[model samples]
Target: MTKTLGRRLFGFGSSGRSAARNPGGATTAADCLRLYDDAAAAGPVDAELAEAAAAVRQLPAADPGMTDALLALGGAALARDLPPLALAAADAVLTRRKGSRAAWHLRGRALEVAGDLAGAVEAFEGYLERTDAASAGAAEVTARIAVLREAHSWRQDVVGALDGTAPGVGALAAGPLPAFEAALGRHLDDRLAAAGPEEAAGLARVVGLHAERRRHQLLPPLADPLQGGTGRLRIGEFRNLVAGRSVCLVANSQTVGGGALGADIDAYDLVVRFTSFRIDPAATGERTDIHVTGHRGALNWDRRVTTRLVFSDRPEDWRQALRTRLVPGAQRFTGDDSLRRPLRTVGGLTPERWPAPLTCGFEMVWLLDFLDVSPRLDLIGFDFFATGHHRLAEAARIAGPSDYSSEKAWVMERAQHVTGPVIALR
Candidate 1:
């Protein structure tokens, strides 16, 4: 597979310049049309492209139609490996039209080229209903649809056993993605043969976590908040291939709320502590930091939030461990047999603070950027962070997981969703 190109590779593009340059410049609609024509020219008319781009940028915040046109131009630039221009154009469009299908579609394509499959999928799916199969931009829309469908199908198949859609004990027994499954299983079997049972057990924990992550899709936790000894919170795991870090260390956790009042403070605190571990840090002397940002959502609606942390240099051994633990149970694919078994405990710390009536979730992203310094990262390290925001509401409405009463716990429950901002650590 070809890698995503960066802004540097495309010479001087829009991202290279400051947003202030054309803040008060004279860039009109006609100027954007001219800029589009010039960008399509053969040689490096960097100056001309910049001028036109600046002009186009000024238009998006003023007019939606112009914003769409700029997004289209950005797509064109991205197709030519002009990362800087394409991204800037997309950024401009997205800024004004945050939920615009055209903006998201264009950004998705750019992300794909940047080797950000996860981000690309997110953007593409965001515009799913807007892009028609036979529209003027049918090709781009269709391409995105194809990519998302394949990835979605694969994810569903891999996690099918976990969801009780299949009756299997492990991935191999699941019989989904036969070839990929086999390869993963074989690799794990060999590793297990060489590992101590404790290490093997740790590996198993990783595998189980991987599946549970997909089964939840970063939704708020669905468990009794006070069930486990440490007080329960729903957790999801996701791995991202970030390009600028090394080792699988927690980058940071961010939470938003009303001054951390009620159960939110304790809940957010638990997440912060859990995700800040220095996984295998001794072997790779790289410093990993986890920054937690918090915000408050409506207290009555769905109180769900998404937190994404970068895991640099994830170990392949982790993936191997997962394959060993899950593949064997995949064959019987018929029920939640795989999840019915408790996950082996891995080397992680649970926070001491136990918060009540609060929910949150985690997106433990295995950032690809960290792999460069910590080459041990594995394929199983995509993006499987966890969440527990929903747990609080469930706790409020219904009794804890151990409490089997079917009666509602809280009538006027609001969901507080948190979405972590992308923190680029260069």
Candidate 2:
């Protein structure tokens, strides 16, 4: 198998969403050995990193330098117990070098050791996907996937929670009603009170999905049931920032076509993007003021971006980031507020729309209320990710058929809420 494919399944580099691997760098086996030794010996990490960095400069597509350097860096970091750095190095290598036979093994090892069994499974599966399935390590990777499946089976936990909750508002436009809120609240409260060590992982996943579903309709009772997106920023504080200003939020959409770098798109006073947000500078303009995301919940786009980033579904991944950390305008939003409104407001909407009623509808309302409520907002390249068959199938399973499409329709209907202007860059 080629090294490049191997790397894509597991490579890591730079930081944030825009970071990509340099395709030009090539490394030799000799460089790999020397760098690995120094990186492993390491009086300081920077010294070893510098050695690997220097080597990458000389690498070309034909040479083995890039792969070797990344391996060396990953190995050394693993030796030092820096799993994140190790994972990053592996990921960086895999991005531009997709054919590496060893990249798969490296990524799987890093993810597994880091407690991200789901990601490890995906990495191993990806390795198996590109390489000869009957190859020497294929059996072991298949075994790993089996183990990971046990964890993914936890998806049923959320389904059960949804089934248990009494249905409410059919239309998100009406917001969460009384009967709906009561049923959902009881369920979330039970989860919150019952979440223990053994069930921490399952509960966390349930909470994450549940809260997100609530957010699709409108901000849940600010309880942030899952504790995933909760940060220091408060609701009013978020709203005040953009209450009367011009703001722009960009989404990673295939429909951007050739307008990503268009001058009008770049002219927005502020720009917001999501996790592992990627764009070609020449194709997409170079302007990003804020990044709104909470790591790759189901995709290994970027390793444990938040301290809340959970690697292991076996353990809770919803811990809070340290107060002292510097993520630059990045924050979380685990719902945290008390709701006291007419129960009918929530109860009035029937479950006819959604038996469970939480679709990942346009989260802009939640954003407008809690994040940046810029009166004038432009949502660019914001297609509902409805292009591919795979996405369609996934959406069917996750959001139900009608809910996803309805969400798009709802967002389009609410365009007037955005300071009387709704620009569709598609």
lDDT of every predicted structure (CA atoms): 0.35, 0.45
Q: Which stretches of candidate 2 lie over 4 Å from their true place?
A: 1-231, 294-317, 320-361, 369-373, 388-403, 417-426
Per-prediction backbone clash count:
96, 51
Give the alpha carbon lDDT tens digit for every residue of 1-426 in model 1. Answer: 011223323433222233222221343445445434444453454453454455465654466446645654575566566544555566565565566665566666665554344555666666566544433234445676686566545545445534532233343331212333444445556657998978677567435644464455558766432111111111101111121123232221211211122232222211221222222322211222222211222121211112222111122332222223222212211111111111111212223322222221121221222112222322111112222212123224432223212111221121122123212221
Q: What's the TM for model 1?
A: 0.26
The superposed Cα distance between candidate 2 and the true structure at residue 164, in angstroms, equals 64
Lowest-lDDT window of 10 residues in candidate 1?
334-343
**26: Cα error in model 2, Å:** 72
